[model samples]
Target: MSDVVLREPAHRVSPRAVPYWRLSAAIGDAIVAIAAVVAYVVVPGMPGWTIVLVLLVVAAAVAHVVLMPRIRYRVHRWEVTDTAVHTRSGWIGRESRIAPISRVQTVDSRQGALMRPFGLASITVTTASAAGPITVDCLDADTAREVVARLTAITAATEDDAT
Candidate 1:
């Protein structure tokens, strides 16, 4: 990290990702929170503890829906190189990763219902490293495909071919 002076992620995720992330998080949060709250209300005599728990859940949902997506959009970024994959993301506890293309095990792209409408997709690169897979979130669908293709070629070219 100290050797390379570059400060920011080489590529920021697509802007459309903000709304797409926000919507999906909000929907999941609402589904769980609303269901719990409704169940509590239907009981007629809501217990004090249940009410407090539900309220706390709602508060968490509110933050998850409102704050997280925006922060993620601002922080999330990734770059693919002939030698490595670089990424940075998260707010409370920032995380960054650098995975060499030679170690990559798999490359995949996915489109969720909400993301599809916005022409967005996420790409994940699994590697042999113990650190965990690296994800490039919220790229333009076409861009994600390009990244996958480029990374695949780079990784394949570097393979040792044990067999």
Candidate 2:
């Protein structure tokens, strides 16, 4: 019922996030590349056109692995203000979400196996919104913990029932 004007968040994710993203992308790409190779080898007397297609797929995968991380690093950002938490994310298309402090229900931090090697974590803020929780990914582990703690304090201090 209300118009929400959105703006960019104030802080970029950790610089280490770039490499973390790159490594993640590379792992996926590697799997794709391997599948392509297996297909080529398993199919006996494969057509020349099929070989060309496989090479194209491999090339595209390589390009995605190389480019996506840098683009994501530039686009992902977050800011926690006295009244709200805001986030911007996505590599190809952008998404921005904001949760008022009074509406925050829970704040959690987590690190996946892949993220731990890079000392990175993600923070999820559960809010009383139909759209679902908002997550700021690839923060430094300590920063993520601090953010969770700060949000807990802010939301606890608010008088709202967080419904």
- In terms of TM-score, the best-performing candidate is 2
What is the per-residue lDDT of model 1 for residues 1-163, given as tens digits with 9 covering 90 to 100?
4587766668899998888888889999999999989999898877789989999999999999899888998888888888889999886688999876777889999988888999999999988877778888789999999999998888778865312
Q: Supply candidate 2's per-residue lDDT for 11.
A: 95
Model 2 Cα shift for residue 2 (angstroms)? 13
* Count of clashes, each model: 0, 0
- State the displacement of the C-alpha of residue 41, model 1, in Å, after optimal TM-score superposition: 0.9
Error of 1 at 84 (Å): 0.3
- Candidate 2: segments with Cα more than 4 A from true spot: 1-6
lDDT of 2 by residue, 1-163 (tens): 7799667899999999999988888898899988998999998999878888889889988999889999999899999988999999999999999889988988889999999989999999999999999999999999999998888888878887889
TM-score of each: 0.85, 0.93
